[model samples]
Structures are given as C-alpha cells and as structure tokens.
Target: MTERIGIVGGGIVGIAIARALTARGVGEVTVLEKERRLAAHQTGHNSGVVHAGLYYAPGSLKAQLCAAGRVLIREFCQEKGLPYREVGKLVVAVDDTELPALAEIERRSIANKVPRLARIDDPAHLRDIEPHVAGVAAVHSPETAVVDYASITEAMAQDVRAAGGTILLGHGVTEITVDGDTVRVATDASEHEFTRLVVCAGLQSDIVAKLVGADPSPKILPFRGEYWALSPDRTDLVSGMIYPVPDPRFPFLGVHFTRGVYDDVHVGPNAVPALAREGYGWLTISPKDTWESLRWPGAWPLAKRHWRMGVDEISASLVKRLYFGKARRFVPELRMADLEAKTASGVRAQAWGRDGSLLDDFAVDRIGPVTVLRNAPSPAATSSIAIAEHVLQHHLDLAAT
Candidate 1:
C-alpha cells in the first residue's frame, strides 16, 4: 500500500519534511499552514544565523543535526542561488567573571568538532576578530554563517510542489483523530486523512498534541524576544557576529550584535514572557493564552526560579537605555544613537515540562499514526532538513526497510 502523509505547520521543518517525503516517493504528501504565507512566524522572525554545533550538549540530537544541517544549508543556498554569508562568530567573555562559562562553551565546541574553532586568551586577538569589543577571552567559530531562512523555506516548498506534494496555506489544523491505521485531520477550511501524520506546529504544538489525546506534560511557553537595528552608518561596529557566553541557568543567549546576510546589524533578542502565544509586543495580549500559562502548575516554579532575570529582561524591553546597556557590554563603542529602531520581534515556543524545566534538546513524541514535535526551538531552523529525515526514518515509517 502506498503511504499517505500529512504534515502540520508550514514552517521550514514541516516543509522540509514534505519535500523529503516527495523526494523519497513516499506517496501523497500534503502540508497545512495556518498562515497565508510560509515562515510567517519563528522561521521568518529569527536572527537568520546558521548556528554551528556550539552550545548543545555532546551526543544530543541538536549537536548532531546542526553539524549536518549547516553543510546542507550552504549547499542548498548555492544550488538555489540564495545568499549565504560565512560571517564568522565570536563568543566573547567580557570579563574574568564570565571565563568559567566561556570555557565550558569552548569544551562543547571542540567536542562537537566545530570547524575552525579557536580559543583566544590574548585581548589583542579578540580585538582582531571584533574590533572595539572588550573581552578577556573568546571562542571563535570562523565558519559560522547567516542566510535567509524564509527564502530557503520557499525554495524547499518549490521542491515539494515540483514533486507533486500539495501545500495549503491558512489551513490551521482544528482537530485531529486517530482511527485504526489512519489519522484524520480537520483544518479551518478543509479536512485530510492520511496513513501517517506529522505535527510540527511550532507554537501550537501542545494544543495540537492535546487534540490527538497525547500527554500534555510539556506545554508551550511563549517567550518574546525583541531586537534593535543599528544605524546603517554605524553598522561597521560589527564586522560579523559578537556574542556573550550564555547563562547556563537559562536557555536564552544574552543580547549581542550580528551582521545579517543582507549586511544589516541587529542587536538584542532579550527573552520575556509574552502575554499571547503570537504576541510580538507589549500591546498584543490574549486573555486565554495568558490565563492558561498563569494557571499551569509549572508557571510559578519557573517564574520563582528566574524572576530576577525576568525582571531584568522585562525592564530592558520597556526601556531602550537598559537594552542598550546590555549591548554596550559587548561593543564598548556602541552608542545610544547607533541603535536606530526596533526591528522585527519573534516569540519562541519554549517547551516546559510540568516541573517547569525547559526542554533543552529537540523532542518528538509518537502516538501510533501521529508524531508530534514538542520542543523544537533555536537550532530548529538550522536543523530543519536533518529533522525532516529523522522524522521520516524514525517516526513516519520504519517497516519499509
């Protein structure tokens, strides 16, 4: 019997899976996206950096897939004539206080076999990489890159279409049912039945999983990250990407500077609790989303543990000076005027368990004919293609072999 496949969400990972199924001739494939356009959410709103195998724990899925996906992305850009910039990245320890954390990052980088990874202790060498930046030491990944992820998503969609896969926009999955060997999915406008179903429903993963009668232990927490664009004239302050050693206690990387593939410099992405799942700013609020989050058993524990950092992030979001202060720590030359305007912001669907601990790695759950992605943030865009292959081989079909 031929396989009939249905995919939820039209983000890069979802589209990539559709494209892979088509390429493998795995029967009829269809992609459902809630938005009218692909990559309308996290995929489009990301920093556009192709993450190297840097921060993930050794032997984790993130570390493995990121190493593979980085190569695949560069090659895809070449074949599709999309812009791919290898602008390098420096993870700087701004002072002695940050040295221990920086060393752990270096250890991970080397264990992950990050290409061309280097450690610099001399302040002058750090300066050579990011001039006008103050740091006691640093770990450099010179092959780190930036690209247009949304464009890449469209390109993959083209492949899926070329292979006769159907992609439906604005088709949010409203309900899902499992009957015998097939999964039935109803959307806002239409319905589909497939031999197998894969849910990559970014921010709505939990809701969709609930529809399938799956465990609801891990809930999606909306964390909005805001960015500021550097004045075009002063973009030279950043030649590539300058980053801080992330706080291990939290999943967020601190505010840093990045030169985008288009040569625009952006600062920030401080994480704060978002009132709505899709909230992009302070004004956007959803009572249902907020109340659900507040009442979750994990909410208070998570907040109690990180309230100080949350306050700091919330403070930074409300005041430009505080945000500037974070960025200023990386680049001493960064002026208040240099941060010209607020750029696009993205809300990450951070998955937290009932215990309130963030899932730090990629997570997938299989419920008979349906597979749901519970936690796929950050390195997800970088690992989209690999993620597709993993899902197809492990979750969707195993008997074909």
Candidate 2:
C-alpha cells in the first residue's frame, strides 16, 4: 500500500475518515481544511443530540449506521474519557391522528435494530419518563445520547496526527485533476498529489466533488437550524429529548426539545432557508450566497413545497411568543419567559436533485480516483465512525486497486 489518501474537509466526518485511515496504517493521510481550526461549521453548530436511528426508513444507510453508531459512539466516548450521556429520546403523539405514524416509527426502530425501544400507551408512563410532555402515546428510545462532537472531532484529528497523518489547516482545495495513477489537488495555499481522494466537505461537498471532475449533480442547499436555549430557571421544562411526529412529506424533523450535553435545554431548530452557507442568524447574509440561493432551481421548488410551513417557520423566527408557543405544545409548562434568544444555528448540507427533490439517504459516488459524499446530515455526526468504515470498505479499498 504505497498510496496516499487525500481528504478534503476538516469537519467531523472528514476527521473521522482521516483517523480511521491512519489507524489502518494506510500509507499517508492528508486532511486539507479551509478553516483555521476544525469543526468550525456544521460540526460545531449542531444541537449535540446523538441520534437513536428512529426516524429513517428501515434498511436505509441512515438507519443502519445510526443504530450501530450509537454503540460505537458510546464505546469511543468511554475509551477516550470524553463527555457524553445516553439520556434517551421521547417521540410524542399529542393526538390520536399521530399514533399510526408513531407506531410506524417504532416498527422502523425495531427494523433498524436499535435497543431499548418501547411504546408508552399510558400517559402516566409518558409522565414518568417525560413529566412535562403532553401526549396520548409516545415512543421511547433510550439509546439516544448527547455529546460535544467538536471534542470528538478534535480527538480524531489528534489520533490522525499521532498516526503520522498531516492535517493542513487554512488550505482550501481549489482544483483537482486525475492523471494516470495519481490525483493532483490544488489548494489556495499549494498543490499536492495523492493516489486517491475522499471528499467530506460538509457545506462545500458538491463544489468539491465538481472540482474532482465528478458529475457535481446534487446541489447543496444549506438549511439553517436555529435553536433557543432555555433560561437557567426554566431548564426543568422537560427531561431528555421530546420530539413531535415529523411531517412525512418533509425531510426535516419538526422542532423539538433537546437537552444538550452541557445541561442546557434547546428548543426550536426550525428548518429555514439560509441567506448564506455559513449563515447563523436572520441577518447573516452574503451577496454571493444570496445570489446562489436566488438562482438554485431547488430553492423555488422547495419553497413552493414548504410554503405554508416556511411561512410558519418565519413567523416563529420573528415572534418569540410563537416560537415558545410551539414548544409549549410538547411541554405545557414552558413559557415565553423561559426562552432566551441564545441563537446558534447549524447549516444542514442538504443535497437536492436537479428536479428539486430532496435526497433522503446517505449518498456515496465513486468515479476513478475520487469518492464523494453528497448527502450526509442529521445522524451524520452520530454515524460518522460507521460512515468512515462504510466508505473505506466500499469505496477506498476498491479505488486503491
């Protein structure tokens, strides 16, 4: 194995891949990150809830990896002495209309092979688990956890470095060309050649894939997920995570309650179109980003599809009462005063097809010397280790030959 594996992106996924490749003693692993530090984008901005593999369809990559990733993540956290907690998640059906969907979710969880999942028929049982939540029935997924993903990413980078791998910061890859047996990567700083390339460039994944002469087909539509942290006095409004039954038509999970690893309760990560790729707030907009959003064919279609939902989200975003009111539906005790405008937003690197349909599964495409990840979201943070393994098994090993 005389090949060097060049990875673009320094987010958690890229860091995990680098670490995994290094541990395998795969010759040389070079990670080129555009930022000064790792996890500067989506990895650092998320709600920090490790997924429980409950929401995705059975047999999909998202379901399998998320279920397996939970165990792997718990073990990794324990081994590394990292901070994490498997506090569990509760998906509530507030009315009879949602029970069928809730049951389907439970069935899907079983199919995904997640452990400790059960249906709570009695409101008393729901109250015992989540005292503040109001629901007729709920699905309890106790394997879900929360952690500082940035910390995990940092540890992965350290492991890569210790394994004689190079992490190049502040180096944005500008161009890529495949020669006979080598791939040349041109960055803003310099150029390097590698025997293979793997791109996990979070928000820039589609663009980076294009640079490698791949079909650059999936368009990365960045959706800003904004959160509201509960005021310290009102932190007891809910225990663990309390989620609503998601809209089947949409790719996003509805706004829910998240108790972070830091002990703060987060609410309202409403899916809204972002003005900038790295936009974290209502006012954070870029000229180029605005231009891109205006021109993306999927933008109008997505907006049209989610028009009413988008209007409601914008209303919630503008009105604090409306935002807290939504949260109050799940946890009746939560008040408007309990909410503080602790604004932190994550950019979901959502891949959209040319016809404007949202891709709902983990996408991996390999062409010649390059392997691309076009759609990696939600459980991507939870499933990163497994995703790395999957990539290595399916793409890297094959590309090496």
Candidate 3:
C-alpha cells in the first residue's frame, strides 16, 4: 500500500511542498485548506518580489534557499510559460550613517554567491537607473525580479493535482492527533488518517505544532505590511525596485518603491502588529487569538526590545501621509496624491522564540513522524523549491532510520 500523506495549509509554500513530494512519487498527498480558494493569506497578499539574497544573514537557510531558489523560480517560470521579469533592485543609502550597512550587504551577497551584485558609487548611475531617486550611493542587485506568486501557487497546485495528489479546499484542520503508525487529521469537513503528515500551516503553524505534541514552541506573531499604489499617471517616476538599506537591528526592510510585473509601482509596507492572524486591516481582531499573542512570553521580549520602533510603525499604520512621506524620500517627485491604499495588506507569520528573540533563520523542528516549519518569512516564496527538497530529505532520513 502506498503511504498516505496529509498536508495542512494551501498557500504557496504548502503547495510547493506538495508538488515536490508528488513529483518524487513520495506518496498520496492531500492538501487541506480552510479558505474556499488558495493563496488567500500571506502567499496571495505578498509583494511578489523575487528576492536576490540581499538582506538575509550570510550562509543561513534564507540566504542559501533564496540564492538557489531565485534561479529555480526563474527557470520554472520560463519553462511553464509564466510571466516574470528580472527588473533588478536598488538599495540606496540616503545618508552617511546608512553607507556602512549598505556596504555590508554587498559583502554578504558575495558570500551568498548572488550574481552581478555591484555597488554604485556615483549618484549619476543612481539617477540613470532610477531617474527620480535621491541617494549618494547604492547597491545595485541585478538579480532581483518580480512575479505574481499567486499565479505560481496556482501552477504548483495544478502540478500537485496532476501528480495524483488531492487538494482539499474549505477543509480546515481543526484537530490533529498522532498515535502509533497512523496520524489523524480532523478538518471541519471530515477526518483523515494518514501514515505521515507535513504541516506548513503558515500563520497557524505553531497552533498545529502544539496539537501534534512539539516543544520549545515559537509564537507566530502576525505583522501587517501595508502597501500603496502609485497613481497611474506618476508610474513612470519609478523604475525597477527601490529599497532603503535596512536597519541592522530591525527585522523589516525599510519602505521603498517596487515596480510590479504588471507595470504598476507600489510603495510602503510598514510593519505593524496585526490584531488578527489573517487580518489585513485595523480593528479586525479575534479575542482568542489576540489573548494568545498578548500572553505569549516571546511577545513581551520582542516588544521590550523594539518598543520605540514598534510604536512608530503602529503610528505610521494609522496615518496614510506619514507612510507616503517615507516613500517620497527616494522619489521626491511623489506627491501625497500619488499614494493610495492598494489592496488588503499581507500578514507576515514571524516566529518569536521563548526568550523573546525573533527567529531570523528558517527554523524547522521534527519529532518522530511529525515535521513542522516554525519560521519562514521573506524569500520563503523565492526559496520554496529548495526548502521543499530539504523537508523531503529529512523525511527520507527518517524512513531510513
């Protein structure tokens, strides 16, 4: 009898893992999703920028997976006849203080083995690349690109289905219990018994992990990223992706301009604490979920460390002009009128450790028949293929044991 595998979550990462497993003929794979359609959460709402291993720590899973996955993604898109383009990105140093950090990112790129990462020393070059940008110096990463991940997710899900894998929508896994050789997954629709289970629940990862009896558990603190679209007439003011050198101590990349594959420019994704896990806007809070977040020991430590920055981000989320004003630093021609609230926001399922430290790397934990992905943030979409392979290899090792 073929081993049956049940996967929870229907986002890009979940489907990517399913595709990888099915392609390898691992087993009969089934994906469980609560939403009526796929990619309704983080995967659907992401900025759709193909990362170039710029901000990740050198040699970490994020750096390795993103660097390797960028190549895989571009190749997959080309082969599948999907629309994607390497529009490149510019990380500018707006002042003297940010120059060192910008330089460090260049050095890290070399260590991460990203292709054609050059530091632009002349403002003339910056102006040539992005005509209406302000910067003394910048790092030009030509490997960066943009593509709709929702489309990519849909493609992967199709592959999963064609490979004889079943994708079950509106099947939210409400109860998970593992005993002996059979693992039972109870969803709202029905109960499924499988030989093994791989849960990539995204925002609900920790919740599912706890159900399967795992420890040293990290809390998935949902962070809302808000974006604004450039008025159609002013779209020409920005070209390619423009980013600010991130503060070393901060977890987020500062606000900047990004040109979409659709030829529209979007800016600003200021990180703010989200009241709901899947909530895209303010005042959308689940009391139970909010209580869990507030009670988590991990939450207080992170808050204590970045209290001021957190306060500022929260304030920016409430004020639209403050958000756009930050973006205008690069494109001075950008008027308050140029920025308008785009779609619903994307929620980042950021994991925080027990000590309250934000887990920066890809944190995967396995115990017996269960494997759970704890923290997988930016570049996760870019690194989906490589990460899926890693997870499969782990499963293979367990089978050998």
Tens digits of per-residue lDDT for model 1, 221-266: 8999999999999998999999999999999888888899999999
lDDT of 2 by residue, 218-292 (tens): 888888888988888888877799999888888888889988898988896888888888888878988887787
Clashing pairs in 1: none
C-alpha lDDT score of every prediction, in listed order: 0.92, 0.87, 0.86
Q: Estimate the TM-score of every prediction.
A: 0.99, 0.97, 0.97
RMSD of each: 0.9, 1.5, 1.5
Off by over 4 Å in 1: 398-401
Clash number for each model: 0, 0, 0
Q: Who is ahead in lDDT, 1 or 2? A: 1
**C-alpha lDDT of residue 228 in model 3:** 87
Cα lDDT of model 3 by residue, 1-401, tens digit = 67788888898888988998888787788999999999988888888999999888897989988988888889889988898888999999988888899988988887887789888989888999899999889999887999999999999889999999999999998988888878888999989998888888899999989888887468898989988888889899988999999989988897878889999888868899888998888878887878889898888878899999998888777887778778888888889988855655789999888888888998888756777888888889999888887787765353332
Candidate 3 Cα lDDT to native = 0.86
Candidate closer to the true structure by lDDT (higher is better), 1 or 3 = 1
| Stretches of candidate 2 exceeding 4 Å from the true structure | 398-401
